[model samples]
Target: MGDRWQVEVDRGVCIGSGMCVNHAPAGFTLDSARQSHPREPETDANEPLLTAAEGCPVEAITITLLTTGEAVFPPEE
Candidate 1:
C-alpha cells in the first residue's frame, strides 16, 4: 500500500465505454444507467486504478491523492 487515493467517476462526463471496468473491475463497475462508477471511493495506490483511468476514452475517471489533493491519473501539469 502506498498513498491513499480518492477514485472518482464523473458520470456526467462518462460515455459508458466500459474501458475502466475492463482495466480494473475491482475498482469500478457499471451502474444501471450504463455509467461507470467506483466500487470503492478510497483505495490505495494500485496499478489497476491507474490503468482504468488511462483507459477511459472520455477521461472521466479521476484518481487523486487524498492527503495532498494531487491528481495522479490524467496527471496534472
Candidate 2:
C-alpha cells in the first residue's frame, strides 16, 4: 500500500482563497463560511493533494502521515 495522509486545514488561518479547491476539487471543499476543508481527512498521498497543500497562500493546509503522524507538508523544518 502507498502512503496514507491525514489532511487538515486551519480554519483560523484560512482566507477562503479557494486555491485548494482549485488545485484539487475532489480533495478539498469550501464550506458556507468559505473555510477550507478536506473532503476526506484520511486519504492516500497524491499529487493533487500535495499541490493543494503547497499552493495554500496562508499555509493553512497541513498533511501528516496517517500512521506515524509525521509531517508531510511544510515538513519538520
Candidate 3:
C-alpha cells in the first residue's frame, strides 16, 4: 500500500545470530542451510525496518527506502 523498503544483508559480515529475525520476523528470515544468508521481504517504507537493522549483532542488515533514497543505519545504542 506504500512505497516498499528493501533490505540487504552482507553475508561476509553476518554471524547467523538470528537477532534480525527475532526483532522483525515479518521482514527477515534465515536460510537455515546457510544461516548467514538472510532473506528479507518487501516492507512498507514507513515500517520499523530500521529497528531490525539495529538488532543485527553483526550490523549485516541495511534498510533502504525505495521512494526517498533515504537509508537507515544501525543505531549505536
Candidate 4:
C-alpha cells in the first residue's frame, strides 16, 4: 500500500489565505468563511498535498503519517 497521511487544518491559526486550496484543490477546500479543510482527512501522500501544507502561511496545515502519527510537515524539531 502507498503512504497514507492524516491531514489537519487549525482553523484558529488559518488566516483564510486560500494558499492551501491554490496548492492542492483536490486535497483541500475552503469554506464560505474561508477556513481550509482537507477533502479527506486520511489520504495518499501526494505532492500537491505536501505543497499545500508547506505553502500555508500560518502553518495551519499539518500532515502526519496516518499509521504512525509521525509529523510530515513542519516536521518535529
Point to the candidate with the largest lDDT. 2
**Which candidate's TM-score is highest?**
2
What RMSD, rounded to one decimal, does every model reach?
0.9, 0.5, 3.3, 0.6
In candidate 4, residue 77 scores what lDDT? 98
Candidate 4 — which residues are off by over 4 angstroms? none
| Cα misplacement distance, residue 19 of candidate 2 (Å) | 0.2
TM-score, predicted candidate 1 vs. hidden true structure: 0.95
Give each model's whole-structure lDDT.
Answer: 0.91, 0.97, 0.67, 0.94
lDDT of 1 at 21: 86
Quantify how close model 3 is to the true structure by its C-alpha RMSD in Å. 3.3
For model 4, how many clashes? 0
Ranking by TM-score: 2, 4, 1, 3
Which of the two candidates, 1 or 4, achieves a greater lDDT against the reference?
4
Runs off by more than 4 Å, candidate 2: none
Q: What are the per-residue Cα lDDT tens digits for candidate 2 across 1-77?
A: 99999999999999999999999999999999999999999999999999999999999999999999999997897
Better of 2 and 3 by lDDT: 2
